[model samples]
Target chain A: MQTVKLPPLFTPPTPDSPVPSVPFATPLPDIHVTLFRNIRNAVDVRNLVIKGDPRVPECVLINAATIVDVFQIQMACTKALLHQQQGIMRTRSLYSEILFNLSPTNNISDAIRQFGISDTTTAVAVVMVGMQAPPEEVRLRLLTLIEGEPIPLSHLPEFTDLPLINRIYKTGNVAADRGQTLALVVGAMALKGHLS
Target chain B: METHEAILIKQGAEARVYKMPFGEGRCAIVKERFKKAYRHPVLDEKLTARRVIQEARCLQRLRRAGVDTPTVYMVDTPNSLIYMEYVDGSSVRDYINSRAPMNDDDERLLAQSIGKSLAVMHDLDIVHGDLTTSNMIVREGSQSLVLIDFGLSMVSSMVEDKAVDLYVLERAMISTHPDTEGMFQCILDTYGKSSKGGKAVRKKLEEVRRRGRKRTAFG
Candidate 1:
C-alpha cells in the first residue's frame, strides 16, 4: 500500500485531530478493476491466508486524516465486486451497511478501546482464519510471500453479488453516557448447501 | 522497511498467518480467524470477539508502555483477523532449541526483560491466561522479546489467576525449551521481584512444583 500524505486540504473530516476535512467516501466506478482484485483477495483469503505463508503483514498505521480515505478505498472494492456479479446463490457471501455514527463524539481510541470497530472497516472482504493460528505455520517456519495470478471477482460468486445482512447497531454508535453497550454484526459465506 | 518474500509461519490454534507485504517490501504476519464447529454458535461468537478485543488491547497497551510488539493494522473484527507489523527473528523456542544457553549476562538480560514485561502486565492487572514460553517471541534488531497471543487473557486483580498463568508457562518451558530448568529460574527470579504476588506466588509455585515432583515420582 502506498502512503500519499494528502496536503492538509485533502484530509477527511476527522473525529478529533485538527487535520483539514474532505468527504473521502466516494461512489464506486463502473469497473474499478484494481479494487475488485483486492476485495477478492481479502474475502476469499482461504487459499491466500490459510494455505499461505507465515510472515506477518506489514501494518499501515493510520492517523485520522488517512483513515477516511482507506474507508473509501474499501467501499470501492466491495462495490466494484458487487457490480460484476452474475446471479444470486443459495446464500449470500457479502454483507454491508449499518453502523452509522452512533454518537458524534465517538473517536478512534474510544472505538478501539471499546471493541467498537472504527468506521474505517465498514466494507472489508475476508476469506478464512481458524480457532488458532493457521495450520501452515507449523510446517514452514518462514514462508515465501504470496505469489500467484490475481483471481478476478467474476470467478468468485461470493464477492461478485454479495448480500447484506440485517442491520447491526443502527440505533446508535457509542452507547448513551458510555454506559454498558453490546454491539453485534453477523456475516458468513455459507458453504454450498450448508444453510437452506 | 525491508520487504522480504512472503513466508508461511507456523499456524496456531486460533489464527492463520501470512507474511504480509509491508512498507519498503518488508513482511509482517497476518492472522485470520477461521471457523470452529466444536463451539456452540453463541459461545463461538462471544469467544471470538472477546479474544480479538483482548489481543488488540494487549498490543496497544504494550506499545504504549514501551514494551515491544507488532503494531496493529486492519482489525477486521468481522473476519476475526488482525494484520500487524511482523517482527523479524526466531521465537525464543527456536533460539533456545538451536543455539542452547547463552552466557550469564545474556541469560540474565533475557530473563530480566521477560520478568519485567510480565511484572508490567500483572501490575496492570492483565492476566495472560495461557502464559507458555511459546507465547513469548524474541524479535531481532532490539533483541527484545514480544508477548503474542493474549487470546485467553483477562483483566483481573486476583493474585491466584496471575500465579496460575506463570505456573502454566513454567510447565510449558520445561517440556519445550531445552535445559530450561535453572535457566527458567532466572525469569521467575526477576518475576518474583516485580510481580504483585511476588512472595506468595513464588511460595505457591513451589507447591505446584512439589505436586509435579510427586506425580512424576508416583508415575
Candidate 2:
C-alpha cells in the first residue's frame, strides 16, 4: 500500500503584525504612495479631467481625475495599480472604467463626474497598486503630474470625503460609526453589478 | 480527488464547496460550479454564470432586507466560483434533532427566529425556493439563524408564491422531523404574527392544501 502525505495547509495568524496577502498573480511589487496635500493647479487638473489629450493615454481625461474619496479611490486604483505593475492590462482602460465602478449608478458620465478627480481635490494620494519597479521610481513618476507632499497611508482617514460618500451611497442618515459606514459602502460596492 | 490547497467540504450535482483561505487571517467557503460534461460547453458556461450571479444578487438583497446571511466577498464569473464568508455553526436540522424539541425553550426560540426571518424575506418578495432546515445555520455564539444558499430563490409578489414558500418549509419539517409537528406549528404561528401579509399567506396556504388533497383523492 502506498501512503500519500498531505502538506500542512492552514497557518495560524501570529501576534506579530500579519501582512495582508497580496491578491495578484505576480510575486511582490513595490507599492509607491504619495499624498499630495496642496494642489495649486486645481482648475488645470479639472480641465484635464473634462477634456482629453490623446497623446497621453494614461493622463487626464474624463475619468482621470483623482478627486474621489480615499476608500473609493483606493478600491478603484488597487486593481489597475496591480495590473499596471505586473505589465498586464486585463481591464485595458482602468482610469475611466474604474471611476464607473465606484458609483452605484449606471451613468458613466455621472459616475466620472462624481467619483472622478475634481477641481476641489486639494489632497490626493497616489498609490502604486503594483510593485513592478522601485518605490522611488514610482513616486517620481507620480510627481510628474501631481503637485503635493508625500505622506503616509495612515493619514488617509483625514482625506476621506465623508459627506460625499454618504450622499453617493445614500447612507447619509447612517449612525456616526465609521466602521458601520465603511461596511455598508463595501457591501454596496461588492454588489454593484448585480442588484436585482 | 485533486486536493491541493482547498479542502472539499461538500459536493452536490450543481457545485462543489471548498474551505479556502480568504485573506491573511480569515477563511472563506468557495462554491465552484464545474462545467457539466453532459451539456454543451457554451450552454453549461451560460447556465453556471447566470446562476452564480443570481445567487450572489439574492444574498445581497437578503442582507439589505435585514435577514441574516453570509457576506459575499467576491463572485468570479469566469471561474464560476462564489467566495463567501465561512459561517461556522451547526445546521438548524442537526440542532433540532439532537435537542428534544418538545421540552427545549431554545428550540421554540429558534423556530420563532426562523419564522420572523422568513416573514421579512417574504415581505421583500424574495421567495426562498428551497427552505429546508439544512439551509439555515444557528450561529455558535449569537444563536442567530443565518440563512444560506439562495441558488433556487426568486422574487415574486403573489400571495400564492409566499404561501408556497411556507408550504415547502412545512413539507420539509414533516419529512425531517416526523414527530415534531408542534415545532412546525410554532414556525407557522410566529410567521403569521410577524406581518400583515402573513395572515393572507396562511389563508392561501389552506387553499393550497385543499387543492392538494382534492387532487390526491380524485387521482
Best by DockQ: 2
Write the residue-wise lDDT of candidate 1 on A73-166 in tens digits.
Answer: 2322232233224232112222111011111122333322222222232222221111133335421321222222334323323331111111
Candidate 1 residue B133 Cα shift, in angstroms, is 3.1
Best candidate (score: lDDT): 2
For candidate 1 chain A, the 10 contiguous residues with the lowest summed lDDT are: A186-195
lDDT of each: 0.46, 0.64
Which lDDT value does model 1 have at B86? Answer: 72
DockQ scores of the candidates: 0.03, 0.14
Q: B39-149 in candidate 2: lDDT tens per residue? A: 899998899888888888777666666677886655556667776778888998988888854575876888799989999898888888889999999988877789998
Report the C-alpha displacement of residue A159, candidate 1, in angstroms: 40
Give lDDT: candidate 2, residue B163.
87
Fnat, model 1, is 0.00
Q: Which stretches of candidate 1 lie over 4 Å from their true place?
A: A1-196, B1-8, B40-43, B212-219
